[model samples]
Target chain A: MTLLITIFAAVICTVIWYKTAPKNEMKVGILCWMYWGASLMWFVDAIIEYAELGAEFFTPETADMINDSYLGLSVVALGLIIWLVILLVSDPKGVVRAALTNKK
Target chain B: MACFLIPAAEAVITTVAAKIIKAKEEKDNGNLSLTDIKTDDTPKLTFSRKLGWLNKLLWGGSALLAFEHIWHGEVVPYFPFLTAVQEGETAAMLAEMGSAGVLMAVLITTVWLGMLGVSYIIEKRPDKASDTAEETQ
Candidate 1:
């Protein structure tokens, strides 16, 4: 469940990053890499668990899947949080810089 | 088992490597300053910055997986830390780590290498653009 969510987010971000490759103000590339890395991590876990649990892996408990989905959402949110911090620190678009300078 | 540990371990190594390389680069190149002059060649991204991308990917991914493991109760706060390891399934855990962990680490590194290659091409674009501009003139 988490794997599905992460993969979806990764794909969406990758498309956006590709479209804005020329002048990427948001640094969507970082977001893309983060999400893709996570997607791969989950993919590997899913494969391994499937190998171990065989058919049982496919039939996860309903409540467990829901909880995993929530965790997936949290992971996406955390990635965005990290990206926000990076943007603030790097200020690639200089929005923060402009605002700070304007205040002075 | 705790396969994510492998990437977590790699994150630690790469983080240290980034710091070391960054220090060396600073000593070699000094501070960066903006200039209005345009030249035949100017790199937009540094080697350290590229490696920083890989480091961030590894660290962020590992942290998320670690959290997931904890959420599933595969990881515990007590000694041994991992429930499987604590249950005396050391052999199985080690096997899983050896196979799955290595594969995951290698897979991520391969992706990062491909990214570096793509970025290299992107970095060369300005030179290509200038060359075309000159040819047009």
Candidate 2:
């Protein structure tokens, strides 16, 4: 499936980046945070969607609740992405720099 | 988890691929003597290496999510919606959901792979030799 291929490709690219990054830069840290945030949001969204799908549709209210939950989680995910972008812009240095320099 | 396993598998493949490329480059350049040399003077990756850890983190997150979904969501109750629907509709819905999950995984992995590809290209830049030599001393 396209999904499998894309996921496989993403892993390759990430490893390549890891191997090639500068010891002094902080960009990698920001990216890591962003990835974690996105993953959390995605997990939440998936759970909500799965829950909605599996439950019996006894009432319209239940459907609406699931929809609202999905929307809310999406907003949260968007917020995480925005925050990551800010972190990325604020410190152009890779996070590795902070750890290294902290020793000095 | 599929996310981590898939990527780890890909990394092994990449290493193999890299070796093949290196071998080919050596053959073309007539530099068998230079093949075993590992130089730190490689050019900088356009993307940072810190990004690599994200894959592990995401994989962990997904595993947790799977656990939560199975334990908290209760697997048996989770799929009952299928039975509630018309007989013909259940299979289609399940298929659709499965497809969506696959798509999401692929999208995330693709971005990860793109970062790696960029890093490789940047690191191979010819200018890093001076930097490498300087670092060696």
Candidate 3:
């Protein structure tokens, strides 16, 4: 479930990024990359867990799904945090810079 | 908690960095006035700016999710992490969180695209006005 969420987010971000590739003012490419990276991580996790759980993997208890959801949200949050850091560092629009500099 | 803290910390750091950059710019050119710094003066929309909207959506969604987790007492302040949900609870969690997560993602994307549409119309208006003016002249 976690993997599915991340993959879905990645796809959405990617499609938007691709359509606006020429203008990319918001630097969504970074977000696309982040989601894709997370999707890949979750994919590997799912594969490993599936191998370990075998038949049991298909029948995840209610608690497991909830936990997975939490994990998925965590991953998504972490990716956003990383992207925020990148945006601040780059200051592409210079809003932060302008805000800090403007004495008025 | 970390989820919330991470973005907060980034905001602080970015502000500080902006201050430093501002200071440097001031020092390099004495005539550089604060009022002169117009961040929105980009004549055309750039790809990065469009992505910025998406970034904002992600931030908002993440913050909401973190708060929700905190409310549910699912947040833990330790390293190997929060209480492990029992096997029986997995199905319930999946049903609830799965739907919620999907809904949040869809809502964010929809809002973003809506904003984009509005911006396109707003951006084009000026051009249209200018074209009309030119025709009249």
Candidate 4:
């Protein structure tokens, strides 16, 4: 269920972003980050849950590898959050202007 | 699963058929004008407007649902069956939490649909007013 919802969200958001976004590179980049970051986070959580459900099927080596990389996902998530914050707060006027001008 | 897989399979077939048709057409016609294929439902975004409370309602609801699942089912189970886990002594707890998650999803979807309806109404209002003004003129 989570996988379905996340995939739907990712595809819809990507299409919406691509269709509606202005020609500005920086703004487009920020929006892409926001969409993909959210999708990535959701995907990871869904995968982890599904993995836990089928843990018996996994080899001990595979389980160990997953456990070792747990912190890496968190780090990436944190970085995305920080990037989102920067996009929201710093030089926000440009974003606001771009958004407003985009209304057709 | 059948409900899910059928549409996905249909989409794949449709896309492949469309590509084949387009390729055959291009081979026969030499060139096709892209502008003739433009869609009318393209999104028009206004930068001056923000989703405001509606955004909060939908996103906040999603966050709440996630929190509810984690806290009640995974972190701390207030009830063994409905809230904690899906089977055995905790089955009831799991069921309850699952119901809550479904409720949250419904609420979020309702709020979004309502917002879309409101936007449509609001956008229509200006056109109506303009029509009236033009009629008066």
Candidate 5:
């Protein structure tokens, strides 16, 4: 569940990054890379567990799946929060900078 | 139990490496314009900048995984740090670190390498186009 969620985020972010590839003023690629890296890590973890548990891996408990979905949502939210912080700090659009300097 | 430790450790090392490489690249900036990724004729992408990408991925992923482990009670705020190790489930924890932990780190690195390759192709494309145009002229 975590893997699927992260992969979804990665794909969406990658498309956005590609569209703004040349300028990249927002640094969207940073978030995309984070998601992609995490997706790959989760993929490895899932593969390893599947190897150990065989068919049982696919038959996870309902409660466990529910828990995983919550965790996945949390991970996605955390990524967004981090990206938001970066955007504010970098002020790619100059919105934050202008607000601070009282510019129109 | 402490699977995130491996990548966290790698992150620390790479963070240091990225700083040193970035410093070196800055030192070379006087000899070349290091502000552009356009690759008009020569690709300005440097090793340090590439390392920065890897460092961010490692650090961000490790941090998220660490938080997840803590949420699951696998990690703790106290001494010994890992709940499994504190309870003497050392063998299982070590086994996880050895297999899943190592594989996760390795796969992330391989993916980063693939990213670098793709970036190289993108950065190289403009230069190739300009060369063909010059040859025709």
Candidate 6:
């Protein structure tokens, strides 16, 4: 489920990034990369778990599914946080700089 | 877990790529001066600038999630470790967390849309006012 959710987010972000393409000012591309990276991580996790549990991995308990969902959400949230930090540091629009200087 | 490394790597790669592209664009446009690129007064509806709402949403949503996790005692006081969700948690607890997660995602996105609307109005206001002033003259 975590893998699925991240993959979904990655797809949506990618589509938005693609539409904008070489003119990305919002840097949605970064978000897309983050989610896709997460999706790949979860994909490997799922594969390993599958190898260990075989067919039983397909029949996860409800609690496990819910746990997976939470994990997925956490990953998505973390990705956003990292992206936000990057955006702030880069200040591509110089909004932060402008605000700082204006206050002086 | 090692999963976190993926996003960390992605962040670095994307940031570098973005910087490169921005530099290339500025060079192509002959705006080689750093100040000219950084201090442009006119908000040229560039793709990155338009994503301001999204950036805000992500920041807000992430902060909210972190707060909620802390409140739930999910975070532990240790280095290189956080969160308590491991194998063999109760089904009810997982369900509750899952539901909350879904709600968070939905609410964040909705709030982002609302912010986008507000920002759109704010962005247009200056232009409208300037046009009005010109007309009055």
Best-performing candidate as measured by DockQ = 5
> For model 3, what is the error of residue A88's alpha carbon versus the real structure, in angstroms, after optimal superposition?
2.2
Displacement of residue A16 (Cα, Å) in model 2 is 21
lDDT of 3 by residue, B1-137 (tens): 22333333333454465556656666655746442333354244543355554555455435444544554566655643433343245555545444444444444456567778987787655566667999999
* Model 2 stretches astray by more than 4 angstroms: A1-104, B1-37, B43-58, B67-93, B126-137
Q: Per-residue lDDT of B92-112 in model 4, one digit per residue for the tens? A: 544543443334334433544
* iRMSD for every model: 1.5, 7.0, 11.6, 10.9, 1.3, 11.9
- Model 2: what TM-score? 0.34
Candidate 1 structure, TM-score to reference: 0.76
- Candidate 6 lDDT over B29-120, as tens digits, reads 68753322322354544433434434444443343334434535564456423443453344644464454344444444454467568866
Which candidate model has the greater TM-score, 2 or 5?
5
TM-score of chain A of each: 0.93, 0.37, 0.86, 0.36, 0.91, 0.89
Better of 3 and 4 by TM-score: 3
Docking class of 3: incorrect
Q: Give the poorly placed runs of model 1, Cα more than 4 Å off.
A: A18-29, A50-67, A84-104, B30-39, B124-128
- In order, candidate lDDTs are 0.83, 0.45, 0.59, 0.42, 0.82, 0.58
After superposition, which runs of candidate 4 have C-alpha atoms over 4 Å from their true positions?
A: A1-91, A94-104, B1-58, B64-83, B86-90, B127-137
- Interface RMSD for candidate 5 relative to the native interface: 1.3
> Per-residue lDDT for A51 in model 3?
76
DockQ of 2: 0.08
State the lDDT of candidate 1 residue by residue for B7-86, as single tens digits. 88998999899888777766666554322123455656766778888887888788778877887788999987999978
On a 0 to 1 DockQ scale, where is model 1? 0.53
lDDT of 1: 0.83
Range of the 10 consecutive residues with the lowest summed lDDT in candidate 4 chain A: A31-40
Question: What share of the reference contacts is kept in model 1?
Answer: 0.46
TM-score winner: 5
- Best prediction by lDDT: 1
Query: Could you tell me the C-alpha RMSD of candidate 5 in Å?
Result: 2.8
- TM-score, each model? 0.76, 0.34, 0.43, 0.30, 0.87, 0.47
Model 5, range B1-137, lDDT digits (tens) per residue? 77777777787898899888777776766646464443445666777788777888788788778878987999889998898888989999989888788888787788779879998887756667777999999
